[model samples]
Target: MVEAVMLWNEPNNLSHWDFKIDPDWKKFAEMAIAAGKAIRSVNPELPIVLGGISPIDPNFIQLMGSHGILNAVDVVAIHGFPLDWNHWNVNEWPAKVDEIRAVTKLPVWISEVGASSFGAEEVQLFGLQRMSELLLGNVERIHWYSLFDLPASWTATTRHKEAEGSAYYRHYYMGLLREDETPKMAAAEFPEGLGICQWFHYEDHRLDSAVEWLHRLKVRYLRTGVSWADSHRENAELWFDRQMKALEPFNTTLTLCFTPEHLGIAPHYTSPPKDPNTFAEFAQWAVSRYAPAPVRTNSAYAMPEEMAAPSVLR
Candidate 1:
């Protein structure tokens, strides 16, 4: 029952991870939005969820909405992984959530969060801290990260056809459940995988993760117009350019949540912004202000149905 596929948290899903898109990276989102639309044309009320690329910041949300994602899903979600692969301190947690809000008006939820042990007590502290923040921040629900400790890292492999089998298994030890779905020592204390959990790292072993998700987005978008695929290519190009530029650090302080390998290339797409909150906020502003000025013509978004308010998932 993979009802939803979304991101975890800022700590777990970090920068080193890259997702590549075939043909082009930017168009990957267009595919998601497009599929959601087709699904909607039939059901008309299914809530499509989008994530697994959020936690870093809200720039992802802005990217999705501006690319026609807002109309695709019923609700948006994100992750908040806080530590590095080494379980080091990552001081920006709540700010990451702010980054999401900076872009779209969609209701949100905290998708993933956990702490791991790597000779640093502070690692677990972050999980406890985030749990407190969630409570204080009025978060409605939060599913703890690892229900068990694998003492190993998450799996890794290069799905990149270009990788030509260059990569191997990745080291990913973080999990709320053991391979058998049993609980780890930390998880045993809290069985449902809620209220906060701990992560175990597999410091060595293999490959990257995001590279696959991101690449899929890019390749799929170019091949198919998932969301706003049918949008005049001119409009998409123009919107993407303006939207990317607008998300720059100027007025707002949200972060820009793009990685270089979003499209499979080193310089594939947008890089991680120094201040994601500012960048994402500014980008949202740009999207709002840059709304295509109505020309005396029949544009794609001219129809009332086309202009309907977007939902969590269409």
Candidate 2:
């Protein structure tokens, strides 16, 4: 059983080519509705969430509401960065929450909020402090943008050379740790006793110390990947069984993200599936393998009862 689903992400950021070319709110609303319906069909109790809109644009939320997107989702999520983006201000967050609430009347989550060091660790620390203070009671939850910084080499492969000079370049330094895995000032500045969650990229799964470090940090939840390319390979079920067994000791809720490379409309992992039915078939297989039911028809697949409901499909 999945708890919740967040459909799409940062739809308001037009820098991504897909949003720039197909910036149709109606089409986006339709897609969100269809995705929500499909998820609910699989697990009716699951809560469907609209992806965080960057900069907390209430006008966009109102537009989504006009197209019935608000009715389809159980929650509205927004992303904010007061220090990097001139369009947003820390002082204005409460009003932005009010604006969104007035339109959607749904629980709002600040799903991605963070500051980048950009060679100024002190400023980043101060920004995080202020962001936390401002958002304390304004939203249901605040999922800070990330847990680790991207390696410099990652930019060369994942982004265009021209992006090196853009505002988006700051993302490479947004993590609690520096690229070398050293703690930054922001890590020390994180508020005491507040629940924190981290996003772990699939590539980092092989790191020996990742889980231990997360446990030390008292992380309650982890948003990680379930790669379709890996699962479709031969003996994939055995591999996943071992992996899940290994992860059981950490005792963290897992939001398993699926990115099917072969089925994607574009070559990129984030692209939508070319055929929804194909993706659905893959999802069923994944659920049956990962859900907490001991060998349901397939003797090779089994998830401990403790592992079932805590793993959400996203």
Candidate 3:
């Protein structure tokens, strides 16, 4: 079951969003606002999260706030990759969260933060130690990037793969487990009670094992996605049902994003949709299906309105 709804994934990043087409993020705010409202209409107590901002930029969050986007969300989130991708040091995490907090009253979340085992497994081990120390109580949530590495044969999703050089290749090594599901050294040190960011592809075979790992890790929260693009494929509902069912044991934050090829302004998945409401419709459908509001009956066991209000993590 979904504990919260995260509107999109890194709208400011070229890898996840086409900023060239909607340079001001006006379209992104519009779609997010609409989706947030739709989600509320379905489940008023469900918290709506503004997707985790990559690069952890305060100016981008300020810009989204200017468009009244922050008003729609109950929490704001950010993603960081200090060891591999970001220029900032790993110790600056508190300052980073402070910068975002100064701009908004909503609780902040470290939605994605990880160290890749690309060069040596020791780097990931050290990163996990430092990350847990710097981030444990600094934010509301910390979802490690993934449970399994991206298979080397599969392309890493990025706007400029060739331009990123070695940095782009690190994507495959960000996982706690290798592509063959062997645990990296860092996996043993993963802090308990923190979440995991493990996106499941359509009909992914790793879902069961992934859940087993989460159980072993004693993780209570999860951050995953239901691609809008994948929703257009055959047997999509069957796959979605199976995926969500398997994940029912944890408190999940469902990220509703990715433009369908047919709905995008351009042919690519990163392109903005021609009609932003199309994305809103998809968000509404997912929430209504996966985390619908409880039916009001004449029973006396219903939660009071105040008690039903959305919780920060749940």
Candidate 4:
């Protein structure tokens, strides 16, 4: 069952959001608020999560809060990669959680956090252990970056491919399994009950293998995405149905994100949509189709037959 729905991915990061066009994040905030409200309209009980912000910036959180974005969603999430991308030491995980918590009363979740085996598998092994120690009980949820390494054929999402050099390569090795489906050292001793962050592209071949691995790990929670951009592809609904069905066993957090190229103000996926309502309508349709609110008929509105026996004379 899908336990929650996230508005987007890392809206503050350059790779996921084109901040140059929306320097103040006002547009992103507007889009998120619309998406959150739409999700709630479908299933009021469903938890709506703000896209996990990358770099753990408190100022950005404050900005979202100022726009009343906080009121539209149930939880605030963040993404961090101390070993691979973050500048701070790994031990500061709790402090980072505190920083987000200080700004809002809503629950804080570590939507994505991981270490990459770019240089050595041992780095990922140690990262898993240390991350568990620091973050296991500190946050509401911790979804380790991925279950499978990104294929070498695909490019990592980044604005500057040349400047990102090592950081760009690290994206491929953040998974517990290699691109060939071989397990890394860290996969064997992975902590139980923790969430995993594994995004499946439209018709991605790794969906079955990822499900097997999640079951093997006794994972209870999963954080994945359904891209609005990919909705335009032929047979996209077929892939979406298959992916969601395959993952239905786990408690999932489905992130609805990415602007369709034509819908974007600019031609990029990171560009804000020309109409925020389009994104909201998509979110509403997804939730209503996939996870609708349960129906409950009130006694006052019950039919006469359902309430009591009808008189023959009547």
For all predicted structures, in order, the TM-scores are 0.45, 0.74, 0.93, 0.94
Once fitted onto the true fold, the runs of candidate 2 whose alpha carbons sit more than 4 angstroms away are: 1-3, 15-17, 25-27, 156-161, 164-166, 192-197, 205-208, 221-273, 276-314
**Per-residue lDDT of 185-277 in model 3, one digit per residue for the tens?**
988888886799999988888999999999988989999999999988887877887999999999999998899988899988888899888
Q: Model 3 Cα displacement at 231 (Å)?
A: 0.4
lDDT of 4 at 212: 96
Task: Kindly report which residue pairs in candidate 3 clash with one another.
Answer: none
lDDT of 4 by residue, 58-127 (tens): 9989999998899999999999999988899999989999998999999999999999999999999999
Model 3, residue 70: C-alpha shift (Å): 0.5
- After the best TM-score superposition of candidate 2, give how far the Cα of residue 240 lies from its true spot, in angstroms: 6.9
Task: Provide backbone clash counts, one per model.
Answer: 67, 0, 0, 0
Error of 4 at 140 (Å): 1.8
- For model 3 the TM-score comes to 0.93
- By the TM-score metric, which is better: model 2 or model 4? 4
Whole-model alpha-carbon lDDT for candidate 2: 0.60
Compared with the true structure, all predictions reach lDDT values of 0.37, 0.60, 0.87, 0.87
